[model samples]
Target: MSGWALRTEGLVKTFTLHLQGGARLPVLYGVDLSVASGECVALAGPSGAGKSTLMRCLYGNYGAEGGRILIRHRGETVDLTAADARLVREVRRETLGHVSQFLRVIPRVPSLDIVAEPLVARGMAPDAARAEARALLSRLNMPPALHALPPATFSGGEQQRVNLARGFAPGYPVLLLDEPTASLDAANRDVAVALIREAKAAGAAVVGIFHDTDVRDRVADRLFTVEPRPEASRSAA
Candidate 1:
C-alpha cells in the first residue's frame, strides 16, 4: 500500500497533421511524473500545454512516441507503451480508471448501466455491479428516476455526475481525472471533492487536471506543472 502507483519516464508524444502535409507537432518531452498511493497530484498548466494529451497518454488512449508509461497492474509494473492490445484492455479494466471532462457512452444506454459496465466487464456479477452503480449515482445526487434513463439528454451537470460516478465506482489503483468538477454547482462540487479525498484516502494514486483553483487546492496533495515545450511547434512538412 505504498510507493509509486504510476510514473512516466522520458515520455514523448507527437501529432501529425495530415491536412498540413504531415506537419509533425511534438507535445511531451521527457516528462517525468510519479504519483504515490494515497496521494493526489494535480496537473497545472495553461491552455495547449499538453495536460489533456498527457492524461490520454497515461490512460493508453494515445501512444507515446517514446519512453514508457509505467503503471502498477495486479501488483506488477507494466509499461503501457509496450503492452499489447489485450494487455492494455486488461489493464484498463482492472488497474486504471479515467474520468474525462465530457461524458461519452453508448447512446440509449441507461445511466445506471453506463456506470456499471466497467465493473461488469471485470467479471463482477451484473447484480452486484448494478447495486454499486445505483449507490454511486444516488450519492452523486442523480435522482432515482433518471437512473433508468439515458444520460445523453441530461444536462451538462447531470451528465458530468454520471461520468464521475462511473469513474470513481471501480476504485482503480490509479485514477486519472480531467476537469472533474467543470459542470457542477458549488454543492455538487463539494461532493466531487469529497469523493476525490476518499479515493486518495483509500490508496488510489490520483492524477487530475483541475482548472478550478478552489477544488484543486481542496483535493490535490501537490501540483505538477507541465511547462509548454517550445519544440512542440509544428515542423514544416
Candidate 2:
C-alpha cells in the first residue's frame, strides 16, 4: 500500500552469443515487474529464463533495450533506466542493493570489509560500517571468529551469509537477489529466508529468483512465473 520502491515496464534484453556457426541468442523477452516498499516477490522459472539478466538490468549492471526502471525516494520517482551510469551507481550505493547468483568476494578483502564496502561507498565511517556489519553478521548467526578472515576461504553457507549481510548492510530501499539461496544447505537456507523477511520489515522492496518451491512460498507475498510463449509452446508441439 505504500509507495513502490522499484518497477520495470516492457523490459527487454538480448545477447548475441557468437556460436560456432555465428548464431545469436535472444535471451529476454519483454518483461515487466514491480515491487512496493516493504513487499517481497519471487520470480520462478526454468533455467535460461532471463531471471538473472533481469536482476542485472534492475541494478544497472546491464542495460535494457526497451523499458523503464523507476525507484521512488521521498516523494519523487527517479527513472533509473534513463539515468547515467554515475547516477545509477550513486543510487545503488545509497538506496539499492544486489546479491548475484555467483559469489564475488574480492580477493584479499577481509570478510568484515566485504560487508562494510557499500556503507563505506556511501560515506560512512570505518568504525560505523564495521559495527553495522558485525550486527548483520550476528543476526545471521555468523561466528565472531570468522569476521576477520577473507570470505574466499569460508564455507559456501558462510559465504552466502556474508553476501546476504553485504546486500542488507546498507539498508537499501530496493534489494535484488538472484538465486540467493542456491548455495546454502537446508539450515542456512532457512536463515536466508528469515533475513529476507527482515529486509522487507525494514522497508526494503525485495525481489528474488529461486527454484525452491518452499523458498518461493515462504518469502514471497506475491508470486510471478516465467513461462514460454504460446508461439514457442506451439512450435515445440
Best candidate (score: TM-score) = 1
Error of 1 at 235 (Å): 4.8
Q: Per-residue lDDT tens digits of candidate 2, residues 1-237?
A: 347788888776765546645444455566778799889988777776667777788888887777788887545788887898777877888888898766687899888999998999989999999999998888778889999989888888889889988987888888998888887888778878988888899889998887787887888998766553344533342
Pairs that clash in candidate 2: none
- The 0-to-1 C-alpha lDDT of every candidate, in the order given, reads 0.93, 0.81
Query: What TM-scores do the predictions have?
Result: 0.96, 0.88
Tell me how far the alpha carbon of residue 201 in candidate 1 is from the true structure, in angstroms, after superposition: 0.8
Candidate 2 achieves a global lDDT of 0.81
Stretches of candidate 1 above 4 Å error? 231-237
CA shift of 32, model 1, Å: 0.4
